[model samples]
Target: MANAQLFKSMQQSQPLPAALARNAEGTPAYALTPRHQLAQYAATGCLNATFYASAEAQLATVLELCKAVEPSFIAQTAVYCRERGYMKDMPALLVAVLAGQGAAEFAPAFQRVINNGKMLRNFVQIMRSGAVGRKSLGSRPKKLVQAWLNSASEQALLAAAVGNSPSLADVVKMVHPKPKDAWRAAFFAWLIGREYIAADLPPVLAAFETYKLDPAQTIPDVPFQMLTALPLGAQDWAQIARQGGWQMVRMNLNTFARHGVYAIEGMPELIAARLRDPASIAQARVFPYQLMSAYMAAGENVPTVIRDALEQALETSLLNVPRIAGKVVVCPDVSGSMSSPVSGFRGSATSNVRCIDVAALVAAAMLRKNPDAMVLPFEHSVVTCRLDAHDSVMENAARLAAIGGGGTSCSAPLLRMNSKQELADLVIYVSDNESWIDAKRSGATATLGQWNVFKQRNPQARLVCIDISPHATTQAMEREDILNIGGFSDDVFKIIAAFAAGQLDPEHWVGEIAAIDIAAGC
Candidate 1:
């Protein structure tokens, strides 16, 4: 004898949409458009083997995506990824594709995307590898490379020399850039192994040469790789640690400790102060997850004072994490695949931070900002993880990441909320978006169905799916209420805030990429 209106409200009112494709785990999922796929790859892809895709597979997919989209879209995506996503390899690869296609948008996009020496090397290497059609840097690309070499400052050029296999010297040999000044002329000659006046060499390069010739001389203020090959004492390592930038110090804390940088008198306190400096952290654009990595990787020999500073740095970096209004629920996917490195596996170059670590960090960060928020860690089902609202983000994240390694069920958390009749204004999911265990055979995905059921109780609720891997599928379709974003960068927080506030258009993430001003010089 229930009221007809009430009974109807309890049932799903809208027809569920069918899943467009299968995920890496053979789960029914909604596929992203070609542009969306490219953006997703550009943001999170590291061109390495992932849990579901091999390096060759990812590369082939990216190349195919470049051809599927418009040349202008490629340019915009490159700019957006480089400027806002803070990505490296993917952006360079995109530019290489544009160059090979002979697209007119290539020049300006190249100017924006190739902003550093490492990027220049990547572009050069990708072009010459014939991966993007043309095997060599053609006239336009060669001119652009020459211009970059000619306009670079002495310090930038020296820093560029730090990496190799197609080192700055190799690049000089390939492009043969004409020097604009005596210092550049000497530097170019020195790099390419030609006769040049040592006195005319830039001050930093001259100092580097002097130190290279005599280990007793003072360590030159060059890239750390430029000095690591030489035998250095404790005092020498300490000096390098003191002079290194915030990012360098953050990444090499263990190296510093191994070489006795931390054992020196008062060096620990000095390094600790630098680590916690707000201005330095901002200037370095330090990602919050990077701090987590540093904290977890610090060796026993590392000073406790420095370790504590890393925690502080993480807190500072998370200042942008939005404080959502009303009831909030954070669902972190702790599936077995998430145990893989967040940046994908690259042999020795693989990142130590797992995808689960980042998922937990995002959940913990949200809880830290919204104290009353509920955290649900899920794999095949909801995992029991009791977190303290008063606990540190690091502690809570550690607790959440330590649980759940079963198959992924993206609907588990939503279904749990539905069973509890929980009303939430916001639900944030940090996952890889491969929901095989709960995937539906027909109609909408199990995730979408569960979301609809949950929405029946709380129609005002908004869902943000933050994909931490480079995949082109999701558990739920993007609508006015659902948002899909990629990458583990802090920028994801800002995008989430804007979407939750109803500031984005229907196109959402793709619109954001399209809005990038690639027409400035085109």
Candidate 2:
């Protein structure tokens, strides 16, 4: 009776039962939801003392706190923070988390430090890895050195240079006392032991001109050592398209779109050709849905021609798709809170894209993968869709988005499924997983309760939760039959395939996905 009432109270968003209320730290026990705790970390530069059961347990909690955001969001926020100059520590924290998790790559952290002047210590530590900082030095090894001289006062530059690589004394001897000559002298000093000579000075000088206009906004694609510099006009973009192909275009699509240069005439055909090309097609086959999701989320007003070409490319690719012998139910949460912008994209302008938009797209993609699957969107209520295999992902997304937003009730789908006697073999919910059920009201079973009720009828049913935001811990994931995965990448579905096959469990699920890039030579 006590347990029943505790579950009932959860429906109204009241506190959990005292026994389950607090974690070892005496903090509210919500899975992964650290909104308030994160704020405390930001202010104190340390996690609260009560987050862990004991001093021994505090270490793991600190690591968990570091990895509070999805991986893709970590990359996005790193770029976003540098561009807009917001939460600089977010990048550092992400790097620290990934490092703690045994990830060796720190290229993103290195670039974040060099370009934005944040996370310098982290960058320095990561640079000790041979592969970390080399890519961001920007063709000319002297670009950062020049920027430092131009942007910093003489004393500031000298102070920064005091920690000797070859030694600050050598750099000071090579540099001029005047700030005007400081950049040229610093550039000369950087080149002293390096390849090339004074003959290469012209291109470096030209690159430095653009660098001075905006030291922080340098494009990663352009090399500092190139003999001539060209504005990122149609000609340069065309050359890039010809040489690097669709993959390159995919990487730079957001950047070009932000710069208003993605829609250059004749470019769509080039992109289409690249998508259709056999080599490019093979690469797509390796990561079909992932490539598609990245391309789709790249910009607004994506040309239909490109979308159609991608559809063809996806159909032709031999990407992994595990066939299940049972019916599948995809539940996408379209609750009111899901309408909020994900990551740092908060404000009215970027509000057009929301967590629900991502969830709906993922559901649509899953529907495409499973021809016999059905989608039932749940908010305060459940709505069924009469979807056809012919509908494009965006069309399905539009239909789901049109369902609009209301209060959250994650259990509604399970309850409705029970009522309809149409339990599924597999049920996947793409949601924020913040369910509020009121036991005081009629028809109120918490999600777990509904799942248990549904299982009595369909013992084989399994639950896979795709968390759009990793801000909170999930209740569904506590069970062996339930799997929780996060991130916006379509490659996550491949992980789902592995999980469904019984080849992976929650413990090794993430480890497997993280190994794919290096494993596949991607």
Q: Which candidate ranks first by TM-score, i.e. highest?
A: 1
Name the TM-score of candidate 1.
Answer: 0.96
lDDT of candidate 2 vs native? 0.52
Q: Any runs in candidate 2 off by more than 4 Å, and if so which? A: 1-196, 199-237, 244-248, 251-267, 276-304, 310-318, 346-352, 437-445, 506-522
RMSD of each: 2.5, 12.0
Residue clash pairs of candidate 1: none
Tens-place lDDT per residue, model 1, 1-522, is 879887776565758789979998887899999999998998899898888898889999999999899999999999988877778889999999999999998999999989889899989989998899988899999999999999999888988887886899999999989887999999999888899999999998899899899878878888888788788899999989888989989999989888988778999999999999999999888878889999998999998999999999899999999998789899999999899898889898788899999999999999999999999999999999999978989999999989858999999999999999999999999999999898777888999999998888898899999999999899988899999999887888988888888998899988988888886643
Q: lDDT (CA) for every model shown?
A: 0.90, 0.52
How many residue pairs clash in all the candidates, one count each? 0, 12
Query: Which one wins on lDDT?
Result: 1
**Model 1 vs truth, CA RMSD:** 2.5
* Ten contiguous residues with the weakest lDDT in model 1: 6-15
TM, every model: 0.96, 0.58
- Output the lDDT of residue 184, model 2: 45
